[model samples]
Target: MSDLIHKDPTCFPVLEAAGLPSAFLDAIMDGVLCSAEAIMCIPQCLDALCLNNNGLQAVRDRNALRCFVKILTSRTYLRALTGETPGSLSTGLDELMRHASSLRGPGVDMVIEILNAILKIGSGVDASFSSSEPASCSTPLWKLMLTGAIR
Candidate 1:
């Protein structure tokens, strides 16, 4: 199932039809923290899933933002950012921006609040995306904000 999603994210509807939306989302969220390969595959999965009405709702229903917060806050994700190119990270931010309006609701307020905090902290610093050192706990968070805003 993870392979299928990685191979063809457009197969989302089929997976949903098979009554596996929860499982599919779980795979995506969990995969993101597993390794660099899974991290790179995530933007494509999000692009395919969040672009459609049903798929977007499924993600929202799953409180996917909370999952995202968990991912963003994880040491693994920060390590990936500090050590590698921000390929999927940038693309994933783009997808999030594209779906920003659609992804809003009471359930998403927490995400919004987090973003606001990032913005406040980010507004104070000129973050260098080229740097490999993790500046602080919020370094990745601010980088993500700047990346998303730059698009």
Candidate 2:
């Protein structure tokens, strides 16, 4: 399975089409990270969107934050066939497989890693809040999303 993420062609899966591309998720995570704001409000943003259907935009006076927030708000937003939920192994693994099969866009990988350093992961106060992660990988979000269950 790690081979899939690392793209180890020697042991690549024989299955057909994977789920959402890693780069897309990475892009969203990267945007959230690079905007350089405190994540103390992410849980609030998430809750407001989920509870009130409030617009993701203007939640924190940033238009860029919407995409990142929307992607995080719903696991199945970009993924329909796979039904990828935020914090579950069955769904997240499927998301990983899908990510492995797809191609990635460039830039922002390092920024997300730095962003992860800024955020306090496993804070245990909220599920929507997440750790910063490398923009090239999908596992960080998946792991962060699943941490809610673990807590």
Candidate 3:
């Protein structure tokens, strides 16, 4: 979470930073905002935190990291990202996993599977994608688990 927040400000330090392209910043902003929305919707905040961490780890580029974090922590953006909600669990985590699994694409099913594993492990599990390929694959899935979109 700290990584995301700390890096977020760089998304747009100035209207014209010269080196920092507007298009790149825009893309990062979109990804960050999307991630935040996913986090808030999910019941498990901790899981969201974990996912942010995992995303941070997945990419080593400092600029990209900063953009992702900035979008996530932006209060104005976060509210819009979550949108209006009655605050109710319309679906279980398992169902979400099934849906994620059903999706066809590279990294799509993998993301869902990872989230399901995270829900099962909860915070008690301490692992990183660097530790193992299987573990790395699970990180994004865990983030999804936090969203409560998967069982």
* Candidate 3 C-alpha lDDT tens digits along 2-97: 233235534323412443233433444355334434434432222222233332222222223233233332323433334332133123223333
Residue 52 in model 3: shift from native, Å?
A: 30
Error of 3 at 59 (Å): 16
For model 2, the stretches where C-alpha displacement exceeds 4 angstroms are 1-66, 73-106, 109-121, 125-145
Q: What ranking emerges by lDDT with the best candidate at the front?
A: 1, 3, 2
TM-score, cand. 1: 0.53
TM-score for all models, in order of appearance: 0.53, 0.20, 0.21
C-alpha lDDT values of all predictions: 0.59, 0.32, 0.34
* Per-residue accuracy of model 1 over 62-121 as CA lDDT, tens digit each: 666555554554444666554454666666656665755666463357567667645644
Q: Is candidate 2 or candidate 3 better by lDDT?
A: 3
Q: If the candidates were sorted by their TM-score against the true structure, best first, what order would they fall in?
A: 1, 3, 2
lDDT of 2 by residue, 1-151 (tens): 2324234333222311242223323344554442212222233222222221122222222222334343433323323212223334233323423432221111133235424533433444444444343333343444434455333
Better of 1 and 2 by lDDT: 1
